[model samples]
Target: MERVAQTGSTNADLLARLAGGEHVGEGHWLVADRQTAGRGRLGRGWNDGQGNFMGSTVVHLTAGDPSPATLALVAGVALAKAVTAMAPGLDARLKWPNDLLVDGAKCAGILMERTGNAVVIGIGVNLVAAPELPDRPTAALAAKGAVLDRDRFAEALAIAMVDILWTWRQEGVDSIVRAWLPQGHPVGTPLRVSEQGIDGSFDGLAPDGALRLRRADGEVMLIHAGDVELRRPVEGN
Candidate 1:
């Protein structure tokens, strides 16, 4: 793997380098020590401290393969497995598409961008605790009593990604779906789906990864894509 290590923001540097024709080949790693311009899902700015982990890897998929959820699934399964191995007692749960959480708080998030058959999978995991984060709830591995050095820990994570991605390529998304279902967001449980125009939609997880919303009129709607933040079912609904 070709590793490009940066002392500051990795993503912004990556975008600049990518824009400048720096060949980001498959299996290349871009790591950051402190991300001044770190980004979370939905273009939100996320900053990481010196000790936390933030990185991106490039993956090449076969041409015309339109598994829209591919990078998210790989990131989800790989991150969950890595955290599980690191702290045996800390059970990891997956939020559909691209989040890994522990005890109802986000521990890691994946942001993917695609260019033809190449995908850039950006990942952020807090190796230590962070404070005053936006969103409903968030967490770091250290906050949950797990700690790891940014580099060695990232190597293990990359290895896990290799195996999972191989399985995904050989088999299908079902490979991950089957593995993730049992580790999935609670089916039939309530969620808050957030989007620009359509927010505040209460929902649950459908079998095919669609968000199922239960509205005020007692109607259930299927949402194909949106930001799903977990929430409790309102009382007396």
Candidate 2:
């Protein structure tokens, strides 16, 4: 683990280190106290909340490994386990492609970037404070009555990730998918695909770990990529 008081972005830093021929072994993590130029999925700015968990780790791919895309599911399961353990009875849940939600409000997010044979997994958790956003609601562990130190949470997350990665490599994507399903929104939960503006119900994940969305016409669509949001009913609905 490498700690810094602040940086532009942990993901960018790690990728640069790798490109410079530095050996960033698997399981090594680069943690930042604050990231000035952090980014999330869809190129959105990632808010830097003091005392939050902001870090990136790398996974070197090999010929025998499962599809690289499925690592999102692996990360989700690991993160869900770590957060659940720390915040007992917090009602934490996961969204497809690795978003962590507490009581339907997002509390954390994961981003994966590939460079050559290495995949960098960056994660951020709102441990001490949550940022208000225009698109959806957000939550923090402190506000939810699950106060935890950033370093302690990082340690727990690291351990959980190592164990889950083992399961991913030893068992398969099937094992990771099975572990992930029960920790996510229950089947029949309403969801929306942001880009396509198409709404559907959560139909679980496909065999290869893609999201399965059941449409209104009873057609099941496998979503490979998109911004998926839980669709809450309108005020008068």
In candidate 1, stretches whose alpha carbon ends up further than 4 angstroms from where it belongs are: 1-8, 64-66, 196-220, 233-237
lDDT of 2 by residue, 1-237 (tens): 789999999999999998999989988889999999999999988889889999999999998999999999999998999999988889999999879999899999999999999999999999988889899999998999999889988889899999999999999999999999999999999999999999999999998999999999999999988899999888873
Tens-digit per-residue lDDT, 153-181, candidate 1: 78888888888887777776667667666
Per-prediction count of colliding residue pairs?
0, 0
Question: lDDT of all the models against the reference?
Answer: 0.72, 0.93
Instruction: Single out the weakest 10-residue window by summed lDDT for candidate 2.
Output: 228-237
User: Measured by TM-score, how close is model 2 to the native structure?
Assistant: 0.98
